[model samples]
Target: MRRSFKISFLLIVMMICVLSGKCRAGDRFIRNSAFKGDRQIIVTFAGPVSDVWANDISNFTVNEKPDPDIMLEIEDSTLSLDKTSLVFTFKDPLNREVPHCLTLKQIIADGRSQGTATVTLRKNYLAHLFSVFLGAVLIQNFVFVKYLGLCVFLGVSQKKSTAVGMGITFTIVIVFASMLSWFLYRFVLKPYHLDFLQVIVFIGLVSLTVQGIDTVLRKVNPALFKSFGVYLVLVISSCIILAVPLMLAANDYDMFESLMLSLGAGVGFLLALFLMASVRERLELANVPTPFRGMPIAFIITGLFALSFMGFSGMSLF
Candidate 1:
């Protein structure tokens, strides 16, 4: 009877200690951690850590998330003034496009040795892709921003009917040309070391895309084909069309990035045509002075448009 009573008392004592947070010797943990930039990581602990353990580079591990194979070499580590955070500097910049993991092992905080804890610094692929698309469309527009495709912007924008037709036709041609150029550059030319042939090859691809589009339109809609007679050929020489493929190759953009940029450029060009056409149509009905009439007024308006687009140069949607 005494033995049973003693065992029950000991069990009650243990439960009380556990419930009061006295059973565990170490409960200090990580509050959160994040990357400050491409070359630094900052970790904040739930409680103050001992400088000896927190500043020791050997007690921490930093690497790309979900893949321990790529380890980052720490150039140096510093504990915060309050000892609640540790900042780790890397020897080189991390891939800003990838998430990284930081492991805090042998943590000594709150006068006790705590277990290992890990924090993941996340990467948002969707946000990055969105920023790229927005950059091409508004921040780096091919027509107003880079001054390319002005020939088409001014030529077709005289009439709303022709401007709409040209915009649609240009979009289809450029998207197709850019995609095909990427495939050839990645698979064919890159393998054979035919780098020098890029300019000639890209031009040929543009010509081919234009030809295919020409045939389809001629068959399905003869009136539309006649309306686009010379302008369709002019698209073959437009700077924006050729520049996109060359930029994709130079930047080594992946398939999705290439597609987004190409599409964004097309939409941006369409926007320019539409805006210019609308204003030009209004100008046709308005009374105007003779000297500042046709092309002079057009150039002035384009200049104002360029200045307006400059405001979006550093804008980020993500």
Candidate 2:
């Protein structure tokens, strides 16, 4: 009993460290702007900034149009020492209907000159949503692009019907799990600085959710449960299942963006599974070489799929 307790305690500590480590943000520029018929735009950076960098109108440019109806004149520029943000108030209020572009020639931060920070000011929320969806599905696909959740992708993709079932299950679970994890991290863990416990908390939430799903399936349709019971159980430990929430936490995506990302990832996983299953199903009839018969052929096909997905690299919605 004492040994078991010690093992459990070590596991808990490890989980805490993992979760806390996951919450640490990386070096990246976070941009935010506000327009309420006001000419002021605030651009914030979550990273560090050097105090020696000049904060002046000469350092920034607005509206790249050669000949413009409305010219953007920077009245004043202010830099936050603690927050590492730059705020600019324009002489004229920006046109909300038309998109505006701004460029910072040199943003020296952390003793390093960030050569250029280009920002496009567009309040098109729908476009942003579509971009997020497209990115998640194609560019950053969980399986092909990100190489996540391969175990389930390869294991249950032998048949199209089974692949579709697993895809649906994954979609439902991932979407719900991401949203739940985001709420927990944002409200409960982050506020209290208990983010170190995120790994354990997220895994616990996912396991409970998968269990709930299994219970429901077993009760409502025993035949279906018998068919895909093992796959459903395996989802609790699926890397993709955990990855979605971890990414959401790391990127600090809002609720809507997180939901879209989860949905896109699920759809992308489903698409890959379906394609692989169809290809594998056809391969069974083909008289292939003995060396490249089963798993070998599957891996080759997956590599081809990954290559195909590479076409979406650097694709931008805007």
Candidate 3:
């Protein structure tokens, strides 16, 4: 009993450390604030050994003298594995409280040739919100550009009733997934330097959470579940349930940005799915060649729908 108690105590302490930020996965122990200067750069490695080849990297002004107003520091740890590559980035760290067009890229390798690239920080709140609205609606539309969740898009879209049901379902799942992912990331994986574990962790947690929610709903509200239970299985298969949360976590978005993203993504997914279903319902009677009967023609129509959504670009709605 004493041995077991000791082990349990150690585990609890480790969990506390991971949440408290004593350790971290990415480089830059400090979260870079939007300071008056050019930019801030940070790089991390897989293992304790220094492996970043920061030479020849362009697009930033280099200083030959002492460290400029901005500087980078490298640390080595012997506890990490050397195989897999991991990258953790926030698209809008400067204006994380708002929204913006953010990009994060990380490449991991064995040799000393591993690095990450992140750009597009929101300068202020107004610009970030505008960009977020516009980007969600049209530019980085969840359906057209990313081709995220399409199974339900073409499945439950036959009737207006079913479409509404599926839309509500999608929104709830996305919101829950996004919130859960952010919690796991901010509170669990990130501090322990286990960011590479995101995919498996997210999949397992989302599957379990959705299943638990489904069970609870079935027990508490049988009628609603009966009406939408058919869609639960479909929702589990839809990648958007997993993708939206992972995207928000990876981007390090604030609560508002994450919520906006989830809502916008849900809308985009619903729009595409409903529109496709409606058009296909009408196209059933249209004349088509034998080679393009069911799926072939559906694909053709989907391509057109994607093309049409592109016209909403350059419009700021946020």
Candidate 4:
């Protein structure tokens, strides 16, 4: 009986080893590929794997270069168990237009051996910047697309000069406020789980920023302030001003991206204001029915502008 039991135990161990080997052989495959930013490349596997061997510099190649560049460092590589992903952060930004290939040879994950997985990095910062700019100015436009800041858009856009001033002011304020709000949300409220206070905090921040700008403008350019100071103060209540920080916070954009978005939004607002001011100026001379002369005609023109901006939809730089 003892001899038979020992033989059975050895047979079971051998079967287990074979099964494990087969499992490892069949499970090696790439799941997805993406970029963290302009530099870091993330490659995910279908199954979990040991990153110890995979992180080696010799195991990876970029652009099929036979001789690796001295600038490329292996220490920048990282592995995440939670997502079953390997991250390779390049020391510098890769060329945007060129198609770059990253090849992983003899990579092992979840005790399974993967032969080779190659991922092409096609995303670039310029494309991303253009996308952001296009999206903000056209697709998700602050005034026409989103219908935000209508109060100032219609009120201040009565004249080309006022429209220009308001556009500049809105751009400056939006950029500064969005950046400051990002820092506050990322570093303070988010870490402490004080998200409930976001609205109050954002409103307060925007009000203070507008007030600060108003104070400075009053001192620096009294004539300009006298002309547009009321509108600047009124911006404290402008939905666009408040919406910028809120949108940035909600989207969880980084500092640079938030700034880009703010600038885009500002420029879009400026464009809308300028366009509307120009149209209204022309409308003054056109013969129109008395019933549709002022506000009605203005609304119709605004709607037309909105429709025209819609043509930019589905347009992307990437």
Clashes of each: 0, 1, 2, 3
Best by lDDT: 1
* Model 3 pairs in collision: 48-76, 48-77
Model 1 alpha-carbon drift over 4 Å, by segment? 1-123, 220-231
| Model 3 lDDT, full chain set | 0.60
RMSD of candidates 1 onward, in order: 17.4, 13.6, 14.3, 20.0
lDDT of 1 by residue, 1-318 (tens): 896899688657645633564222223487767677768888888889999887788987888855798788998999999998889999998775555777778788877888887666754556767776788889999988999988778888987777877777788788989987987897788889998899999999999989988887899899978877556787876899999999999887756677888888888888888889999999999988899998899999999999999999767554
lDDT of 4 at 153: 82
Off by over 4 Å in 4: 1-122, 221-224
lDDT of 2 by residue, 36-123 (tens): 3467777778676664564657877778333345457888877776756767888876655345677777778777877777666655
TM-score of each: 0.66, 0.63, 0.60, 0.64
Please provide, for model 4 over 29-96, each residue's C-alpha lDDT reduced to its tens digit, 9 standing for 90 to 100. 77766666667778787777676776676888775222335334444778885747888877777544
Candidate models: Cα lDDT each: 0.81, 0.78, 0.60, 0.77
lDDT of 3 by residue, 1-318 (tens): 896899688657646744464222333321332322223323233344323422213222322122244323212211124422222232222323331221223433344333453332334555665566558757878778778777667667667678877877877777777766776787689889999998998888778767876997899899999987777777778888888778877777655567678777777777776777778778877898999987778778878978887777655443
RMSD of 1: 17.4
The C-alpha local distance difference test score for the whole of candidate 2 amounts to: 0.78
lDDT of 3 at 60: 25
List the pairs of residues colliding in candidate 4. Answer: 48-110, 49-109, 49-110
